[model samples]
Target: MTAMHHLTTPDGIRLAYADTGGTGRPLLALHGAFGRGRPFLSLADRLGPDWRIVAPDQRGHGRSDRAADYGREAFLADTATLVERLDLAPCVLVGHSLGGLNAFQLAARRPDLVRAFVVVDMAAELPPHDSDWLDGLPETYGSLDALRTEIEARVSLGEPLHFLEGAVETDQGWRLRWHPDDMREVKRQVFGEHWADWYASDQPALVLRGGASPIVPDDIARRMLDRPNTRLATIDDGTHDFYLTHRTRFHDAVAEFLTTL
Candidate 1:
């Protein structure tokens, strides 16, 4: 756990973010659904002190207050606000999955705020899916073991622990901090082609895809690099969570991009 900070948006949503405190050049990182800013502290360590990493919990995840909606506009607004309020403009942006879409969308809409961006295991095209997968996910469990059991039984992730990583302990019992309905809404809005948004920004970009990802296919990953000033790298045998599982390789790729900038 590094230094934590909070921001209250114009519409009164309270957002949380983690700052790897230092005078290094700033880099704003965004996590996918069901994630928080705490994970980036380790990423800061890996990327070294040369880049000051700032990660937000986004609208309805982690310590951030839930908003009225989880649509594309809402997510992008929060990110732009964070970067501007924190004086992090012209900084490098990094995101994964849902966060990856947000990163590039923000860059597309506000290129002045982003000097460069990295999109990890996400593409402009996404197939629509239903929220039936979220049925019956309880918010609370009697204990960490209980929580683990339910998540293990119901949810599938790159790692089972990932879903549990954000679980919180409470006086009544253990519970997941994020609301299941919120996640479901986010997922519902995540689908559809975003090629226009993808090519909107001329900013330098890096696209990182897992070699074996089901979310991002080989052709789509290659298409992302079709944009000028964009670079593509695939992590061998990596999954969507390659940035976490294959951290060293992920860092090496990012570090190389940082040098280029």
Candidate 2:
């Protein structure tokens, strides 16, 4: 089971997180856009009892406070604050998509705060993409079932339930906990050429990419592997959200990498 917790940032945003209590090395897990920290609970469980895993909902998402700023600097600052406030420095940092980019940048900015890093299905230079589905999503649905049906039609068949992780019921109707505009802004800020940050630190890092993901193509993955002290693992038949789509394989790959650290 995971315990709920909150940490206030320097900017006064009350960020929410899930903690898998244990007396072992701390692993800071970060979720991608439109996601909270809850999905990592299963991965934390698979990591066994020896690892204390903490996954935080980034700003503007989940139960966390919304912020006006959604830039790279702000995201990195939030992670840094969370690490310092919780005394989780020198811990392993694991992130997916947006979170993955944040992890690499944070590790570069404060090497002392991160002992190792795992970036899942994100690359330094992301290809241009479309988020029209997210931007065009209806704010409210008549019922949760209706929302799920819509999501199933528009999103992935693999994890329709995962898309509903951040939904909540209200007097008005059932809707996502986050504002679509915030997510759109965040997506805008996250996509770009970021090889410099990826190469900023020589700390041990693992780059996990979906074999079929266009986000991190073969050439870019090879370039990412060119850096010293970095390793690459491909999850065959996995998409950009391979961490969720292939949980067991992702967990095993991460577990093996942790042992190397």
Write one digit per residue (lDDT tens) for candidate 1, span 11-115.
889999889878889999888877776665676777788889998888888888988878999888888899899898899988988999998988888888999
Q: Kindly report which residue stretches of model 1 are placed more than 4 angstroms away from their true locations once superposed.
A: none
Which of the numbered candidates is closest to the native, going by highest lDDT? 2
> Which residue window of length 10 is worst by lDDT in model 1?
156-165
Residue-pair clashes per prediction, in order, are 0, 1
Provide TM-scores for the models: 0.96, 0.95
What digit string (tens of lDDT, one per residue) describes model 2 on residues 98-200? Answer: 9999999998888999999999989999865766777578989999999999888877423565568889999999998888889788989988899998889
Residue clash pairs of candidate 2: 90-113
Model 1 — TM-score against the truth? 0.96
- In model 1, state the lDDT of residue 260: 93
Cα RMSD to the true fold for all candidates = 1.3, 1.6
Task: In model 1, state the lDDT of residue 103.
Answer: 89
